[model samples]
Target: MRINRLIYHEGKVTNPYSVAPTSHFFGSTSQSDPLFWFVYACGPLPHTRGYLLFGSTLLSGWPVSTVHRKEASRFVPSSVRFFSFHYLSSASSFLHPLKMEFKKPATVLNLANIRQALVRMEDTVVFSFIERSQFYESPSVYAPNKYKIPNFSGSFLDWLLLQNEKTHSLVRRYESPDETPFFPDQLEESFLPSLNYPPVLADYADEVNVNDEIRTVYIEKIVPQIAAKRGDQDENIGSTACADVDCLQALSRRVHFGKFVAEAKFQNEMAHYTNLIRNKDIKGIEEAITDSAVEAKILERLIAKGHAYGTDPTLRYSQNPQSKVQPEAIAKIYKEVVIPLTKKVEVEYLLRRLGDDDEAEAQDPQRKTQLMNRLLSNSLW
Candidate 1:
C-alpha cells in the first residue's frame, strides 16, 4: 500500500512519497510481504530552504526543496540543498554531525526526529559503558564519605557529580528539558542567557524527574554488570567517578526522554489519553503508550550496537572476538530498567497532564500531591 499523506509541522511539510518493496535506499523484507518507507522534509530554515529524504526507495517526482513538487532535479533559487544517498541499517549506520535545532518545536518535537536523537544517544550510552569497564567496580567511588570534603556528606561520586552539574549548569545544561540533574535541588543558574526554547511539554514536565530511580538502578544493577570486576581501586577512584557520571547522564537523558515520547503520543492521540487520565486509568494509559514491537526492536538494535561498538574493528579477523561489554547484557538493562523507567515517567507525566486545564480538580495543591504519591507508589515497575 502507498501512503501519500502530507504532514504539516509548524510551517514545515513532510510528505512520505510512497512505500514499495523493490525500491532501493534501505529496507528489510520477508518472503510473504515487503515493507518499504520513504519520507522527506521540505521547509524553511533561518538561512536556508532545504529538503532531505530518508527511505529505502528513491521515488522520483517528490519535492526536494522549496521548489514545486515534481522537480526533484531542479535546485532551489537561493539555497543549495545537498542530498546524501545512503542506506541506514542498524548494524552499518555511521555517525555524523547531527544538528537538531530546538529553536522551534517543529524540528525538535517530531517523533521521527526524536527517534533519530535517541538512536545517536545509544552510541553514547554504549561507549560510556565500555569506558567504565576499563576499571573495576571501584566501590569506593560510591561509598559515602569515602573521600572527605569539608562540607560534603555524600560519596566521592556524588561530590564529583554535583560539581560537574554546577559547572555545566552555568552553560545552561539543565535548561534543556531532556536533562534531569541528580542534584536538582542545588543546580545554579546559568551565566549564559536563557535559550527561551518554545515550550513543548506541559508545565509540570519539570516535576517528572526520575533521576533518583535511575541512579539507584544504575548503581545497584547496571554498574556491576558492565564493570571490569568487583572491588574498589583506590588509585582509579577519581577516574571512576568521572566515567560513572557520564553513564548516569546518558541513562538519565535516555529514560527521561519519555517526556518527549509522552508529549508526542498524547498530542497525536489526545482523546485516548484524555479519557485514560480523566478516569484515573493508570494501567490503561500505560497500555495505550506501550508499543511492544518498538520496544523489541529497540532491544534487538541495542544488542547489535553493543557488540559492534564494544569490539575493536581491527580485530574483526580475530577468533571469537570478544566485546568489552556483552551485547545481551546491554539489551537486558534496557529491557528491565531503561524501558520500564521511561514508561513510568510517561505515566506520571500523563496523569498530571490535565493540570494544564485550570478546571481540572487535580489542581488542588494537597490533593495533587497526595494523588501523585499514591499513583506513583502503586505504579512501581
Candidate 2:
C-alpha cells in the first residue's frame, strides 16, 4: 500500500541520523538518505519481490520519457511482471466500485472471440480509412487509396465481391420464369388462335346472341394472349400501375388505343343503364337490380336489342309516322346506348380472355410465352 526505504548491510542496520537508540527502527530519512543507504546495500536484488517493487516504483518516479528504457534495462528480459496491490478485500468486492470508477477489465478472449474482435476491428479500420480518405482526397482516388494500405492484401475486397455475387445470384433465382426464357417466343401465338368476325347478316341476326358467343369465342381464341400481354404490361407498369397515368398510357398505347376507347364507351353505357334502373318507377326494381340473375337477364335483353339496332341498318329507321326519330336522336341513341353497350361487351370479353390466360399460366408449371403478339401486331405505325 505504501513505499518505504530500508537499508541493511551485512546483518547490521545503518542510521544516518546518528541520534537513534540501537533499536531495530531508525529515525526519519531524507531523500538523500535512501540513495546513500542503498549504495551499501546488496547489489540490486534481482528477481525478488523487493527488487521488483523497488524497480517499478523507481522507474515510475522518473520522467515518462525515460521510463521504458530504464525499466527494460533493470528488469530481467522477458520476465512477466504481475502487480498485486489490494485496496479492497476481494476481487468480487472490488468489481462494482472499479466498474463505477473506471472501465471494466475485458475478460480473456478465446479464438472465436479473438476472430470476432479482429473482424470488428477490421471493419472499424476500413470505415475509418474510408472516412479519412474521403475527407482528404478527391472522390476519384478513394477506391485506389482505400485499397492501397500495405497490409490490406485485398481479402476484404474479395469477400465483398463474393457477397455481392451471391446476392445477385439469389435475386436472379427468384426472378419470373418468363424473364429467364422458359418458353419460346413463337409459342405465344399458339397459346391463343385468332378468328375474324365475318361481315355476314347471320352473324348479326336478331335471334343470334353474339355477345356471350363473341365473348366465348374471344376467350377461346384470344384470352391467353391478352393475359400474357397483361402480364407484360404489369411488368412495364410495375406495382404502381394504377397510380401512374403515364405508364398506363404507355401500356395502353402498346396494347391498342381503339380497344381502350371501345371499352370506355361500353362502361359508360352500362353505367347509364344502371342509373336508369335505379331511378325507374317500377316497384321492386331495386331488388331486381340487385339480383344477379335478373341483372344478367336484363343485360342479355338489352344486348339483343342493341345488336338489332347495330346490325340492321334498314330496321334502324323509325317506322312511326307520328313520332319521327331525328338524325340527332338516332345518333344520341347509338352514342349513349348502343355504342356503349357494344363497347362494354367487347371490353368484358377482352378482360375475360386476359383472366383465363392468367389462370392458365398460374396452373401451368412450364412457363408458356406470356406476352400478346397483338402488342407487336397492332402497332399504331
- The lDDT values for all models are 0.69, 0.26
TM match of model 1 to true structure: 0.74
Compute the lDDT of residue 338 as modeled in candidate 1: 88
How many Å off is the CA of 21 in candidate 1?
10
Minimal lDDT window, size 10, model 2: 100-109
Report the C-alpha lDDT of model 2 over 243-329, residue by residue, as the tens digit: 222221222221222232222232223343333333542333222223355334434543343334233355555573221212233
Best by lDDT: 1
Steric clash pairs (candidate 1)? 25-56, 26-56
Clashes of each: 2, 3
Question: Candidate 1 lDDT, tens digit per residue, 292-377?
Answer: 99889899999899988988998867997889999999999999998999999999998888864623533344654564345333
Assess every candidate by TM-score: 0.74, 0.15
In model 2, the clashing pairs are 223-353, 228-370, 266-344
